[model samples]
Target chain A: MSSLILTHTRYQMLEQMRIPISWVASAFFPAASMLAFVVPFAAADPVAATRATGSMMMIGAISAALIGLSITVSQDREQPWNHYLRTLPAGPLPRFAGRIFTSMAIMAVAVIPVLVIAALFTEAAITWPRLLLGIGALLAGSVPFMLIGLFLGFTLPSKAAIAVSQLLFFPMCILGGLFLPPQIMPDFVQALSPYVPSRGAVELVWSATTGSAADPAGLVMLAVWTVAAGVAAVWAYRRDEGRRFA
Target chain B: MAVLARSAEVTRRYGDVVALDRVSLDIRAGELVGLLGPNGAGKSTLINLFVGLRRPTSGTVELFGGSPRDPLIRRHVGVTPQETGLPEVLRVAEIVDFVSAHFPDRVATPELLDRFGLGDLAKRQVGGLSGGQRRRLAVALAFAGRPKMVFLDEPTTGLDVEARRTLWDGVRSFHEEGGTVLLTSHYLEEIEALAQRVVVVGHGRVLADDTVQAVRDVVGVRRVSLVAGTLPELPGVLGVEHADGRTHLVTTDPDRLVVELVRSGTPFSGLEIRPTTLEEAFLAITSQETTSKETTSEETTSKESTHV
Candidate 1:
């Protein structure tokens, strides 16, 4: 199973490597955004600037997760390559593990530049501990949403999935403080925001950058959402097991 | 002896639709079995089940005496789906190599490509190839793992006549090398030419399973041709058509008719005697089913009328 997972991971890496433009954008976008902060109009507090930068990184991570999972799963579903894969001796574990590993790897690459940009542009104290926590939080935050994308890719029609992905992408970003600070929102909205996976992820990122602890409840909530989405994906997969490419 | 493949009471359902209704079949080593069915007849579903793409809702599907999902079984099974969609960006050789990576003992891909007439296109990207070339490439990929059991769904769909004949040779060669093949196709001629035994599926059920000759026997074979000049009235003649100064007659005994015609000194210009093709047998069987269905409906309707 481990070997199969590794094989799938390798396949995903190869697939990502094939898309040169996407790779370049994912690796460079964070640095470009960080440079934007150098303008005089930006807020002076390095912690605030770092928090904002971290939020942008969260956005990139989520987008990467969505696009990676969506395209990979959708193409597999559409072409029904899984049918061929499933016929092999490797079983479902290798195939599923490969997909998850691939998405995670893409997420990892996407997060790197954001961290680098945040480290460079902000005068806010950046400790190794904070960096690790921020990375961990970002990953945890993206997992559930990525699972959501997986569900859509597996369950929805391709056109509908694409539309929904586009529709949810910006709204989730806006609600999670990608373009604005959560603090500026009305208290009721802010209170409601953490339930959103993006909001929880962004908060985690902010906490990591500021050397503060995010709401434990929010992290727990994100974990729960992730678990639920994962379960849903598996269930959806099993229910439609035999009917692939039918 | 190679176990080849086996399925015991394998059933698969999609919500309210039963895609395969309690199907069971077995093929011995080196035997080419044809899965014949019209659209939505569960041929593809059965192939998917055998290949472990779909788990049976009930019962078991085994390959080489092991569970379908067993790695040991998978190592020996190769599949080519009806819809061949190889990665467009990858070269034919790269596609073959990528698939080969999964198997510990991969076949020499160049040899398979050469056999499939794809050696020239090995370095060419799949997207640039014609439909038939891509299909040939897909078959080469299936052969790369040197599987003992191969499942080919409509294996020769887009191929020209020559290409199809070449594919038939490939299939025969696989059997010669002690490989088992289960093929599904709507093309009856292909099945007749390749399969030793043929299984007919209808409404997600196995309607008939027998040797190709046995299936033709069950369906009944007869030669029919147009005879010009004096018409001889005969019993058990299934059909007669009079057109263009010729009388077409379908009879179970063609030799008897030929002798009769010769002895009678009948002047017949168009004397064609052809054995019953698989297409005729299939049509007869399915049409018989439809006739039975219509009879049942009529009986139900008449009973309702009596009640009224």
Candidate 2:
């Protein structure tokens, strides 16, 4: 099973590399936003810059995780190659794992440009251990987003997946206070910010980078979103299987 | 011979639409059967059941004497759907290797490519291949696993004469090596060329299940042709198609029609009558069966539409 999954990952990654546009599309936006927004104003202050950098990284990861996976998964469903894969005796597990791993790889690639921009242009400071811890947390936080991507991909057509993932991504980013610090946000948004999964993700990154305490309520909500997304992803996948093949 | 696949009074429905109406079929090992039907005659639905892609609403489907849902059975079965889009990025050899990995045993990639006449295109990306090339690759992928039984659903729907012949050669070789095949196609020539037994399906039921020659014999319709400036509605004309300066009419009784034509002084010349070919047989069989079915169900105000 693992060998098949590894092969699937290798092939999927090769397919993505051949396309190139999908990775570039997800990678460009957050890095562009970082250069345009974070590097200009937030760079002078070390703590502020680090927080902003963490937020930007999550933004890039979210774009890759949500929009990228959703679009690719939906598009794959429209292909006959996917049908052939599904009918294999090994079932859909290897392909699904391959896709999830590929999404993670894309998210990792997307964050690199943001990290480079922050390291070069900003005063954001981080110890090696702190950076490692922060990277781990960010990877963990991306699971819910990946799950949401799967839900969207299996439930909707490719065109609708593109529109819907984008629509959902932006609202969550803004509401989670990724664009601006929660302290500077309006009272109502500040209150709602901690409940959003993106806030929980960014909070973990911020805490790891700056030695600040993570928000317990925010972490709990992130866990909740992860669970909810997990259920929805499974339901969507099974529904797709039933509707198309059964 | 052992039964390779069997559907025992299987019925399939999509909501209110009954796609397969208690259809029963048995495919024995070493048999190359042609599932000949017009669009929406339950050919695909039956294939889906045997493939374990869909479950029957009633009765049962078995593959290799076991349930079709068994992966053990599916592992030995291969299918090429009516339409498949091969991975655009993968080279032909890589696609063959990747899919072949699923089975315990498979044909080597190079040999598989050569057999399908895709040896030169083995290094070419699927996206760059022309329509016929991609088609060859798609059908080739089905054989890579070296399955015991193969299903080709209208495999040559859009291929030209040469491409279709190439595919037919590959199919014939597979059968010669003792592979069981259940092929569906609108092209009567394809059926005549490959299938020894022809199963004619209409209105979700089998109209005729017999040897290919027997099915052709059952059609009974004859073709009549003439070069008339204007052709009127005639008594026995079942279908009309015009080409060049002449109109072709298919009918059950050409002698009576010709007599009527002579008595009416229809000013027709260059008259000829010919035996019905497989195309006319299929059309007549399917249309006749469906028309009869329509009469039986005509009283129901709300009937399932066959548009799809």
Q: Which predicted model would earn the best TM-score?
A: 2
User: Mind giving the per-residue lDDT tens digits that candidate 1 earns over A106-169?
Assistant: 6678777766655565554567887778877777778877788787777776677778787888
Tens digit per residue, CA lDDT, model 1, B1-308? 56567888978765556767889888888889998876666777777777766678898888778777666668887877433556666677766766777787788878889999988888886779999987787676678888888888788888899999999999999989988899877689999999999999866678889999888878675756765767666544655667776676656667777777777776777788766778767766666666553222332322221110
Candidate 2 residue lDDT tens string, B1-308: 99999998988776665777888889999999999876667787787778776678899999988877666678888777323467778888887778887777889998988888888988898888888777777777778788999988778877899889989988998899999999988788899999999998876788899998788677778899989977666777778989899989999888888888888777988999998778887888877786666523321211212110
| Lowest lDDT block of 10, candidate 1 chain A | A237-246
Provide C-alpha RMSD values for all models, in order: 6.9, 4.7
Q: Mind sharing the TM-score for model 1? A: 0.80
lDDT of each: 0.72, 0.81
Looking at model 1 chain B, report the run of 10 residues with the lowest lDDT sum. B299-308
The Cα RMSD of model 1 versus the native structure comes to: 6.9
Flag regions of model 2 displaced more than 4 Å. Answer: A183-195, A241-246, B13-17, B55-60, B65-72, B81-84, B160-162, B222-275, B290-308
